[model samples]
Target: MIQETLGHLLPELELDPHTVSALLCASAAAVAALNWMQRRRIQKKMEEARRMRDLGLQCMEKAVQRFKQQNPGADPSRILSLPLVELAEKLKEGSLSAESVLYTYVDKALAVTRELNCLRHVIPECEGQLRDLQGQKEKGLLHGVPVSIKDHIGYKGHLSTCGFAPFLGPPEQENSVLVQVLKHQGAIPFAITNVPQSLFNYDCSNAIFGQTLNPWDHRKSPGGSSGGEGALIAAGGSILGFGSDLGGSIRLPSSFCGLCGLKPTVTGAIGPMAQDVGGLALCMRALLGDALFQLDPTVPPIPFNEKLFCASTPLRIGYYETDGYFLLPPCMRRAVRETGELLQEAGHTVSPAVPTSCSEAASLLSPAAAALQGCIVFMVAQDLVDPGLKPQVNCYRIPVLVKKILALLVRPLVSPSSGQLQVFYGSLPTLSPQAYRTEFIAKWKKLQLDVVLCPVLGPAFTLGYPGKLLAAVSSTMLYNVLDFPAGVVPVTTVTEADEEELLHYRGHYDDAWDRRLRKVRAVGLPVAVQCVALPWQEELCLRFMKEVETLACERKKCT
Candidate 1:
């Protein structure tokens, strides 16, 4: 059949067999050349990445040697264990030199990166920063403290490679406003951490820099786009670090790593993560200072409000165990319950809070929404998309009618009430963005709540599940759309009882995502609850987080 059809077409075109063969040969060679060129380009990027990694490691070695010679028989572990505020106080009081703190963290950061593949590029200029700080008459708040930043945050003469090959171009000419604020406050920006490709997935892995593993367990994910910051800080590589969150990027990783983190009410918001809540407060105080306001005039000219943060007055706090959109795991529900009970014991009015009946808020604010909004342009013309992000991109490229049909077909197979169906069903706008935001804000006002307590998400899933479990983030996503300040505080660890609960787990809808989530070996993982406040109430949010941290610590001692 093929010969007869070709034979007739060839004769009608009046082309000989040799002509057809030649055309086919030319097409094959063209394809081969394109493939060769693409391979060379990626090779060049990898070479540069290695060069940067090696240079940072070499700088680390020199600093560590110098530190040992300067302070003979000093225990690095002792310094490593100190919280951010204590470390800063030591530096200011002259008991610990700025050089000693810098060198100690640099050494630990190197070890953490070696074990977890977290650091994207270590800033060798931290030594210069120390020298400059020493010459100053009045030291700033974060005096001589070493800090790690997300890979996408800008620094002078460094590539802000957001884990994409094509982003490997000329370095940024100057530090971003946030970085400038850190430096002015005497904080040394020492390292940049890894992120998922295009900052698209909650799980951190990209083709260029590879994957970043959890410090608690190598098999599980740390969470992204701030996964590296979470992993590094959890391993005690840095006392304080900064990461941006669009949708649970900062909160999820922080919860997974058993660290405290915040997501402010700003788009592409940059906030701090630390092992203790005090560290977060210090970082927030520094970021909201006069320096930040001057560098970025668009930012509110509000300095850190000490009165609001330190007020002992009780707050009317609302709590929720589930969002009704996605099923909450038993451990997650327990985290919220325990947090509420702790708050009540401390004299706060804690009550249940329910959101309006619209569940599409998270779907509209998710990474998939960013893809449909044209944020993934850098992903085009690449060698390949990471497996975690490929599904969202394909969903974006699918035809509208086809998506509707696919959504219908996927419903029964995944779950009758699975939140994953939103990806396909969201092909058309469901609600006005403004209307959704107003409804949630109205609920908050009606309840007269100063803050809300809820689960950050089911404790970190196994690596590579972030792409599949987008709906699980609904508990955290509502605040993102409302532009409210939200934070995560580690309240408990996954218990033997929690693990037992998982064996009998069937979600509200018995969803496929829940079944897959229950299979994650998270027996010993940390479980945390999210704390949220109204817009511009970051300090209040941090205050609530600190209260949770204090209660959890006391509870642990009693246990």
Candidate 2:
């Protein structure tokens, strides 16, 4: 077959065999040289990454080591051991010195950065921030609190690298609005954390920062793009951390690390964009009043409504295990189910609830996947992407002819519903995400539930496994698709019983990805459930999260 095809093509070219052979040889040589250049480029970036990381280590170590030597009696680890709410109280009472609190967290952050590679940079200006707070009788709400910033959010005089190498040159000229607000609240930005390259993948590896490992078990990935924050908080390196979530970035990391995270359905049309913002940022805007709305006039003039947040009425809770896209593992399903039962026991109504239909959404994933890949390629060169992400870039480069071929090959093997992915992937997706959100909102309103509970990326993926487990994010992604406010709370940890149950697990799907779920053996890792409410219902979302957290504490006590 090969000889016949070549025979026809060679004749059409009207070239001698020798000439054709030489042309092929030259093309191969050119390919090899390009490969070498790519390798060299990656090597150079890796060296730069290590050098920058080492410098951050030096700065962190010097401050932390100095604090340890000066005040030997001061418990360096105690600040991290306390809760964020408690940490704020101590600072408010003037019982804890801001300098010492910053020093303690910096000490832990340095250690965590060494072990988990979770920081982009340790805020070098923390000393100046502490000095300014001294002797102030009226400190802000977060007074003396150490907050870890995601790599993408801007801080004055610091680089917002967002895991891109070319984007790593100069420091930012101004603080992002969120940073300004946090500063107003007396919060100190102590350190910046690592993220996946382009802040796209769930896995935390990137050419610039390498990989941010799960603090509990170094073998697994801490869920990302806010992964570094998650890793830091889980390791007791920071009290409160901030991150962004286009999909499930904050929720996934929090769930993976056994922490709390919120993703508000707050619209940028009504929110401040001067800084990278998320759920809590909206709350800040709400609390700070209309002045913030004036600062960013594009934002909705909505302030934090204390009445909505403090309302303690029981919620009608909806829960589900699968979105009919990615079937979760036994452990994750159990976590959601257990949370539903717990919420019911606490006087909230809980029942099985389906999300705004997956049929339309499933068709959107392929286009969504392509667009996600397209954005990366458009912003970065092939060599600049982490080696792990490069393959994805190539796969999404599906040409029209290639897409047709792939559709033909794949359609026969998968379910009729999943086949829509081929059609969506081959075509261009809507540029503005708001169009789809409009449709999802209509369906969600009909469900009439105040809160919903689901898994956060299926029991924290094994290291390097999240990119392959994209569908597992469907449960969380649906909220992003609907622009709903969502919160993640550590409900339980994966137990020996959970691991045993997984060994015999048979999920709703029987495909390659489902088998991977069955094979995962994540014993002793934290498992969390996501709590969600409709758009502009962030106050209700947090309220349920607090209730869920209370129930989690009770479950821990009884166990």
Candidate 3:
């Protein structure tokens, strides 16, 4: 019976018995050869990576030891105490040399990078750059300043993989606009930091460089896709760093890591010397100049006004704690409230405002935009993801088919709840082009609050929980949809009393989300809030943020 069955199935198998045996043998040999080749390649790559990592680590260790040896009485607290602006001033007046400043920061940054996995590549070339800049007669504002950039921002002749391994050999022939600007201003690009695989998610995890942890708390996340920049800056590794934001990439990381970041109004700060993709260039032009400038060059150029940063009066501030979809985590809620109170105390008019359903708008806009763009996001993700996560990648690649099969098979047994269904459904929409585009456009239009203040997410949850609160990202994505400038300010830490308040809370929206909230409450996380300004109103946003920071300082002093 077995022989007869095999004979019947043999025709469908498309090989004669002898041929199949021979083919199998050949395939086995081929697979063995391929495996050997792969093993050799992996071993070579690992050896190179190890050498680079070890060299960086050893150099940093020596630098730190030498610094301490030279200045035995130097205050260790100086590492964490001084802000970058003051450090820059000190470096300018001959009080600090380029060597001393760079050594100190490089030492600190390298140490932090080792601890947090924040760096993709550290440039030994920076030491030379610093020495050369110091010898120059004319020094720019950022002269001798050490700055780290996000990996996505290209640096000439340096590896610009943007966290993908395939692009890891050397720098680009031309620098990105921001990089060129930084170099022109005497900012040394010493290192490039890690990013999310697709530069989309808030969690800073990639297979190439791994995860970057929060400097304040190791087990928690530092925001992403500019997360490494946030961690490095906060850890006192770099006096100043450059980060790009689309959604809450820059602001979220800055907030999580307790550092200040500025996301300039679209094109208000762009320079012409660097290369930019058309969409970004267009976006920048739209925000900085006239929309008609796209068609006609005869339009007057609208340069970035320096006066915007030095505005005398505080502007009207609009604030909210939650945006209906998800409640603010205590830390984020406190940050927003404290910021609002501070602005009010500082004599800025503060008004409570509720933002409309921006998440719904984002949900609507994603489908249509994704469809129109021909699923570029998916393709980018596929290209960047590590082979180790191939299964996860496949789910995203064929989301509709895979999700339906998953829903029919796995979901029923594993996640029978409606909430789980919603979560599952969220992943499936990426597969539908028209659905993604329609959702994206509608979502964009729906989030129309004029300078809204909201939470970046719930309170600072631990590292592994970012996916759980993915929906909460709607707060940040709303501004991304509107192309507005949003800034995050750290307000306060979670207190025992805050935990107590949460203990008795009942589920308001749904039992599942409420349970997630309660789990978050148990963590005792820090709180921060986002203050968003209309496009090109970054100055106003910063002014409001300063007021909020002041209030937070006062509250701390009182406590």
Off by over 4 Å in 2: 1-42, 135-138, 267-292, 365-369, 378-385, 419-444
User: lDDT of candidate 3 vs native?
Assistant: 0.61
**Model 1 agreement with the true structure over 1-559: per-residue lDDT tens digits:** 5445566778978777667767878999999999889978886887787687788788778878887897897778888988889998998787888887788888899999999999998888888888898798888888899999999999999889888777888999999999998888888999999998878678898877788999998888999889999999999998899999887889989988999999988866999999988988888888898888888887899988999898879989998888877777789899899889988999999999987643667655643574543556445446456776666566556655676787667666654334556554552346676788777888889999999988888577788888777677777777777788999999888988988988888776566777777776688889999999989999899899888889999999999
| Per-residue alpha-carbon lDDT of candidate 2 for residues 116-140, written as tens digits (9 for 90 to 100) | 9888888888888888888566777
Worst lDDT window (10 residues) for model 3? 271-280
| Cα lDDT of model 3 by residue, 268-302, tens digit | 22211111112112223323434334433543356
What TM-score would candidate 1 get against the native? 0.94
Best by TM-score: 1
For model 1 the local lDDT of residue 140 reads 86
Check candidate 1 and list the clashing pairs: none
Worst 10 residues of 2 by lDDT: 268-277
- 463, model 1: CA deviation in Å? 1.8
Give the distance in Å from residue 347's predicted Cα in candidate 2 to where it truly belongs. Answer: 1.9
**Sorted on TM-score, highest at the top, how do the candidates line up?**
1, 2, 3
For all the candidates, what are their Cα RMSDs to the real structure?
2.5, 4.6, 7.1
- Model 1, stretches more than 4 Å misplaced? 1-13, 366-380, 387-397, 405-419, 427-429
